[model samples]
Target: MPPAIREGSLVFPKVPVLQAAGPLGLCQMVETSILNILGYATLVATNAARHRLAAGWKKKLFEFGARRAQGPDGALTASRYAYLGGFDGTSNVQAAYRHEIPLAGTMAHAFVSSFASFESLKPATSLLGPSFPNAVLAARDSVFKLWHEKNFSQMAKEGELAAFTAYAMTFPDGFLALVDTYNTLSSGIPNFLAVALALFQEGHTPQGIRIDSGDLAYLSREARQQFKECEEAFNFPFSALHIVVSNDLNEAAISALNDEGHEADVFGIGTNVVTCQSQPALGMVYKLVELEGKPCMKLSEDVEKTSLPTAKAAYRLYNKAGIPAIDLIQSASMPPPVCGRQLFCKDLYDDKKRCFFIPKAVEELLVLLIKDGKLLQPLESIEVCRRRCITQLQHFRADHLRLHCPTEYKPTAYATAEVFPHCRHFPEWRKRENCAKQTRKCVHQTLTRNRGEEITYTSQATTNALPFKRIEGSAVACCCRSGETCEPPATRIPTTSERCAGNQTQKPGLAVPHRAMCAACECGQCMPHSRISSVRRGISKNAGTPYPRVRACRSECRNSATMTIGSLIRHAHRRR
Candidate 1:
């Protein structure tokens, strides 16, 4: 067995942890974990065009696709199968909505192109302004160029450059050109810079330039030169313009071009960034695994192909250095991966456990994601998230990258849990067998088998993984607010058990399903009646899993007191 490694960044799962971010150390640790998870096998986009693509799923050329599915529910199975994988955010709005996700983008440059000039764009911009200030820029880059002067003119007309500056603040300051339509390096930039200089003189600030075509490198150089040369004429920045590099931009190509000090601000990539163009479309199909209440997962030949059974949450453990060290797939009731991390065992009916881990910054991202659809807080704009991605990519370790030879971002989980990124297709060629099963078992019994004859399975964890027993909230990470315990009422106790099971004789202040008998108790005692015994018993409850904190008396009214299993469970349920 490995020595108990001291621990990395540890995060406590909130009933939803996405609301507030973990600490910087915790945040980095989490980010590393998920970056690795997503970086693993990858959620590749197959549809390079029309936001739709052909998937690896088999096509059944049944003389007739489906003349009629059985009566709605009867045929629902086949119907669901047909469109099961061929869905996009737009095509499957229901899916996105249910998952608390928004559909992919609609309206594109094509839509904006229909408008011939800036004047044409006015009505639309005016219509969208109250809600979407950036819509104008996003829709028509060309219209922006032609009427930008007018836009500045409007700002100057409104009052002074301040309004224009303020207006620009809401709008991303970058101004990219469809440089290809006209001369990007030659006439396009020179003419545009002249206009920009004219605007700057009028009090409008030109943010940056975008190069859409023509030997991006050459055009970029030309654009820079032209902008610099015309600075006196336009008063444009020689150093500050962000050149958005688009046109077949991806990690590799960008790296090569970036090495040359290519001039581009932000990338205006479309199909590639949005569509995952390089990866052929194979729909990422998700099913209701153990819906309502049942154990389930797709049983693929590859064991790692499965998922977390039932309702599970994702978390990351950060190293002491504040970098993510692993990605953990845990159940709702599991304890975080602190020293006393709990493991879910079905036989014991563990509510949660840390099922998976990877050496990367992934958890931070997960924490930022919405939980129970209740966001920790309103998130920053997409632009902020995008900027973060760019910033993080710049600092990430290179080895964490596996562009061509795609592989699972290897992670660590419980010895009993199914290992992930297990070469499902090439088992003989691979050799990671910490928890790899050598023999196949009844997939039904384990729900580990897939359509193919393989023992792939979702690892089922116990509820013990969840943070349930803390006095007020989860124990994963504490507010540690003052760095010292605060003074409490004479009745208040410090232990988690005591906190939940307050003084039963006291009034039930809040709805603490945790300590049922103490429903009236507000004093921080493990149990109102048991408070006296607890002092003698000592705090013996384990940290992570929900173990019985208080021993119940045989009599509901409680005359004599000994540990009763029924009382133990009753006290546990009260905390809920």
Candidate 2:
């Protein structure tokens, strides 16, 4: 996995988190632990931050993912990370208690449904409604009539109303209702309003309403409109009520809600928050940069996968506008950047692409988290981390943090020629480049040398021990014993002309005789088949497209089991 940069810092395609010079074994041993710790935490935190950003800054964002998390430990981890990523609170009680995060959520659908069988008071049977005749009873009857029009089960609606009444009686001050168990508009809202109005008469303020299912934005708006009318008609205290929406909300859904103009006062986000539904892993990794005081780098065909080969100090250089102009990584031995001097930093891959900045502020990014194997810095509070996250996000440019097609913010190395003159990465990079050139040169020479001749360089040993059959027209290096041939099994199938002419001369549809085919060497060179007992196909020079394929000799001629024409060419090129 790739390393994770600090939050709100300019993120690019590939960015290193930390670089150090230390013993190889010491650094390598802790790689797995480093990856495990940062991977999920960073992903969850980033996801939570995105959701917070999508939901307006003023709106309440609650993390309710504990129930859906892997386990109790996972729940706590998710809750802590979510809190640090700008979540207002978490529904996980243990997380709240442990992390000192604010706790929220009063009840679920089960709590409301528990009172479904309770008896309710009607206008005719009870003095409660008729006692207030023209004022309360009139408004209640009107609202009930409107709601009852679309409601099919009067009994079910009554049950819901009874449930609301039971909840209000239990916790009169905390009267928020989950209003989507049945029909939200027809049954839930009306029943909730009835109980809410009663609480208001007793000089109690109804907390709010929650819509768990349905079009949340539309439902919230409708519910709010109804509450406003009820406030005016019944002269009840409903104006300050909060409308909460919770239905598997993630960043995209929250963004859509904001765009469509939702009336919801709070969002209870769950699955996507803890699990990081969109991107589950952060791909954070710890790699060895330098060992034994000497710069070291991992060699790979993929440059992005390779790590920088030195102990480096990273700094954020702020421009005149107080925005980060560039993130500069320099050799640890170099002096910290000064404000007045011009800072020249170049892209690590493309040396020509450089940026010069006269920084107003030069702030070092890395500090001693641990010293002498003991932690130097104290663990930060969730609130402190959350505030820091927000502060960092404010510094990040809007263009760099867009939901789609974010602009890349590539970090540059300061004075690469001077600082990294003896760095291991450059030499390794040049070595690979040279190896490629040599491979190509040897391949060209072999193809030219063996052309027009029925090359038969076969080894005397293992002549009868070859497992795979040498099919005359086979494009692939290896084949089944049946002598039947087709395209290579891999994605690298050679075209018709290339397949026919790859090893030996095949006149159109005519198969070249087995003895006439080119024999591959122990070192993977293409020669006459007479010197080699058996041969297998080598790596294709042009992957997926048939080109210079050097079959490796099956007999013990060189180091390995077999060699390829490509390998032979590489060997030849290296010798020269």
Name the best candidate (by TM-score): 2
Candidate 2 error regions (>4 Å): 1-23, 120-156, 418-576
- TM-score for each model: 0.37, 0.66
Per-residue accuracy of model 2 over 1-576 as CA lDDT, tens digit each: 112244433344435564433455766777787678767777788887888778867899889898899788889999988888888888899999998999877567776666644354333433333443233334456566644655534634666766776666666778788889878887788877777877777677778988899999899999888888777877776767999899899888888898898899999999889888988767665666666567767767876677676677788888888887788777777788999788666677764466566899987776656555665657666676788788877787888767778787787776444345422122112121112211211111112222553322222122221222232443124221222222332222233223222443233342222332233321332333433222223323322322333333334334443344345555333432
TM-score for candidate 1:
0.37
Model 2 CA RMSD to the hidden true structure, in angstroms: 15.1
Which stretch of 10 consecutive residues in model 2 shows the poorest summed lDDT?
Answer: 437-446
For model 1, residues 374-410, the per-residue Cα lDDT tens digits are 5455645433432443333333333443344543343
Q: Once model 2 is optimally superposed onto the true structure by TM-score, how far is the C-alpha of residue 411 displaced, in angstroms?
A: 1.8
RMSD of 1: 25.3
Q: Name the runs in model 1 displaced over 4 angstroms.
A: 1-178, 207-209, 232-239, 242-245, 280-300, 306-314, 330-335, 339-398, 402-408, 415-576
